[model samples]
Target: MPQMIFVNLPVTDLDRSTAFYEAVGATKNPRFSDDTASGMVITDAIHVMLLTHDKWRQFTDRQIPDAKISAQVMLCLSHDSRESVDQVVARAGTAGGRIDPNPVQDYGFMYGRSYADPDGHIWEVMWMDAAAAEAGPEAFAAEAAAT
Candidate 1:
C-alpha cells in the first residue's frame, strides 16, 4: 500500500470549513466524517481532517492557537502548472479565504501563492517545472543562463 498523509486542523465552524475546502477542490469523504469532523480529500494521498475545537481536544491536550493571529503550521500543495496554482488560489478567495496571506513566489521555473482558510490555516499552492526541479537549482540556473 502507498503512504498517505492526513493533516488534522481545528476549525471554528465545521460546515463553513468543509464548504471552503470543497470550493478549493477537496471532496468530503463521508466515510471518515461526523458532526465534529469532516475528512476532506485533496488527492489519493493527501487528506485534510477538519475538526471542531471540541473534537480536536480529543487528540491533544495542548491549547489550540488562533490560526488567524498565530500560525502553528503552513501547509502546501503542489500543482502541475502555474495556472493551476493561480486557479486554486482564486477559488479559495471566492470561497471566503484570505488570498495571498503569504507573499507570492515566482521563480522562472517555479511559482507559488498562498491563501488562509476561513479559520486562518494557510495553504500554499505551488508549481515547478519537473525537468528543472529534477536537475537541481544550480543546473537549472546554468541552463537558464545559457538560453
Candidate 2:
C-alpha cells in the first residue's frame, strides 16, 4: 500500500481554520474531523490536520509557538505555472492571508511567492519549468550570472 502523510497544525480557531483551508482549495474529510479538529486534504497522499489549541495540547507537551511571531515550519507547494502561483497567492490575500515581504523569485525558469495564512502559518507557492529544471544546476548558474 502507498503511504500517506498528515501534517498536524495547531490552530486557534477550528472553524476559521477549516474555512480558510476550504477557501484555499482543500476538501475536508468528515471522517477524521470534528468540532475540535479538521482534516483538510491537500492531495490523495497528503492531508493537513487542523487541531484546536486544546486538542493540540493532548498530542504534544511542548507549547505551541505563536505563528505570528515565531517560525517553526514553512509548507511549500508547487503549481503548474507561474500564473497559477500568483493566482493562489492573490486568493490567499483576499481570503485574509498576509503576503510575505520576501521578494518574488524569478530565475527565468522558475517563479514563486510566499504568504502567511490567517493563523500565520507560512505557505509558499512555486512553479518551475520542467525543461529548465532538467537542464541542471549549470543552466541555473548561467542564467543567474547573465542577469
Candidate 3:
C-alpha cells in the first residue's frame, strides 16, 4: 500500500472549517467524521483531520496556540500547474480564507501562493515544471542563464 499522510488541525468552528475545506476541494470522509471532528480528504494520500478545541485536547496536553496570532507550522501542497495553484487559492478566498498571507513565490520554472484558513492556519499551493524539477535547480539556472 502507498504511504499516506493525515494532517490534524485544531479548528475554532468545526462546521465552518469543514465547509472551508470543502470549498477548497477537499471532500469530507463521513466514515471518520463526527460532531467534534471531520475527516477532509485532499487526495488519495493526503487527509486533513479538523478537530474542535475540546477534541484536540484529548490528543495533547500542550496549550493550543492561536493560529491567528502565531504560526506553528506552514503546510504546502503541490499542483500539476500554476493555474491549479491559483484556482485553489481563489477558492479559499471565496470560502472566507485570508488570501496571500505570505508573499507569493515565483521562479522561472516554479510558482507558489498561500492562503490562511478561517482559523489562520496557512496553506501554500505550488507548482513546478516536472522537467525543470527533475533536472534540478542548478541545471535550470544554468539553462536560463544560457538563454
Candidate 4:
C-alpha cells in the first residue's frame, strides 16, 4: 500500500471548519468522519483531519497550538494552473478566509500565494509547471525574451 499523509488540525468549532473545507473543494469522508472530527479529502494520498479541541487533545499530551496567534505548520497544495491557485484562495476568502499580502508571481517555475483560513490556519496555494521549473528562472526569462 502507498503511504499517505494525514494532516491533523485542531479546530475550535468542528462544524465551521468542516464547512470551510467543503467550500474550498474538499469532500468529507464519512467513513473516517463523525461529529467529533471530519476527514477532508485533498487527494487520494493527502487528507486533512479536522478535530475539535477536545478530540485533538485526546490524541496528544501536548497542548494544541493557538493557530490564531501561532504558527504550528503551514499547509500547502499545488494546482495544475495559475487560475486554479487563484480560485482556491478566492474561494477560501469567500468562505471567511483572509488573503495574505503576497501575490502569485513566476519564481522560476513555481507560482503560489498564501492565505489564512477563518481559524487563522495558513495555507499556500501554488501552481508549478515542471518544464518551466526545470528551465530555471534565467532560462525562463531568456525564452520569454525570444518569444
Candidate 5:
C-alpha cells in the first residue's frame, strides 16, 4: 500500500500560509518548493500542498469557496491526551490560529477541539487514550457511559 497522503489546499498567500503551518509544527519539503507553491510536510506520510491562487486554479475548473465564509474540509489530527490538545491549541492561537469556542470531551477516553489556520482552513485537534479508546465506541455510546 502507498504510505503517503497528499492534500492540496488553496491559499491566498503562500508565505503567510507557510508561516501559519510552521507555527503549528509542520515542516516544509524543499523538493516541491518553488515560487508558485510550498509543500507543508505534516508527517512522513502526510503532506499538505499549499498552492497560490493561480497555481491552485490550474488544478480545478470549479470556483474556490471562500473558506472564511464556508469551509469545505475539516482537517483532523489525533493526540495522546487532553493536555496535548490544549498545548497545541495554545500554540496555534499564539501563532495566529483561531480556536473554536466549544470542544467535545469524552472524559478518560477522547476529546476534540477545532481551530482555523491563518488561511482559514479548519483543523480539528483531537486526543484519544488508546487503552481507554480500546474499550470501543460503547465507551462513548452515551453520556451515561462516559461517566
Candidate 6:
C-alpha cells in the first residue's frame, strides 16, 4: 500500500471548518470524525483532520497561533490545468474564503494562484507542464531570463 498523509489543523469552529473544506471538494469521513474533530478527505492519499482548539490542546502544549495574525504554514495543491486552479480559487471565495492577494502567475510552462480560507489558512494551487518541469533548472532559468 502507498503511504497516506494527513494534515491536522486546529480550528476555532469544527462545523464551520468542515463546511469550508467540503466546499473545496472534500468529503467527510465518519470513521474518523466526532464532535471535536472532522476528517476531510481530499483524495485517496491526502486527508485533513480538522480538530477543535480544545481537542488540539490535548495533543500538545504549544500555543496555537491566530490564523488572522500570523501564518504558521501554507498549504499547496496541484491541478491538471490552469482552469482547475481558477476553479478552486472561485469555489473558495464562494465558500466565504478570501481571494488571492497576489496576481495569478503564468510562466508558459507553469501556472499558479493562491487563496486563503475563511480561517485565514492560505492555500496555493499550481499547474505545471510535465515536460517543462522535467527539464529542471535550465527551463526555469530560461523562463526567468525571458521575463
Q: Identify the leading candidate in terms of lDDT.
A: 3
lDDT of each: 0.96, 0.88, 0.97, 0.86, 0.82, 0.89
**Candidate structures ordered by TM-score, highest first:** 3, 1, 2, 6, 4, 5
In candidate 5, the residue pairs with backbone N, CA or C atoms under 3 Å apart (3 or more residues apart, or in different chains) clash, namely none
Which 10 successive residues of model 5 have the least lDDT summed? 101-110
Using TM-score, give the best candidate's number.
3
Q: What TM-score against the true fold does each predicted structure earn?
A: 0.96, 0.92, 0.97, 0.88, 0.88, 0.91
Per-residue lDDT value at 128 in model 1: 94
Write candidate 2's Cα lDDT for 83-104 as tens digits.
8898888888888888864578
Q: Could you tell which candidate, 4 or 6, scores higher by lDDT?
A: 6
The residue-by-residue lDDT of candidate 3 on 26-134, one tens digit each, is 9999999999999999999999999999999999999999999999999999999999999999999999999999999998789999999999999999999999999
Tens-digit per-residue lDDT, 1-147, candidate 5: 678988998988889888888888889998997878999898888899999989998989989998888878888988877888888888888888888734655565678887887878888889986855777766556644556
> Higher-TM-score candidate among 5 and 6?
6
**Candidate 4 Cα misplacement greater than 4 A, ranges:** 101-105, 141-147
Per-residue lDDT of candidate 1, residues 17-134 (tens digit)? 9999999999999999999999999999999999999999999999999999999999999999999999999999999999999999987888999999999999999999998899
TM-score of 1: 0.96
Q: Write the per-residue lDDT of candidate 6 for residues 37-73, one digit (tens) a residue.
A: 9999999999999999899999999999887778989
Error of 2 at 66 (Å): 0.4
Give the count of colliding residue pairs in each prediction: 0, 0, 0, 0, 0, 0
Residue pairs clashing in model 2 are none
Q: Per-residue alpha-carbon lDDT of model 4 for 19-138, expressed as tens digits?
A: 999999999999999989999999999999999888998989897878778897888898998889889889988988888634656674678987887778999988887887787777
Runs of candidate 5 with Cα error greater than 4 angstroms are: 101-107, 140-147
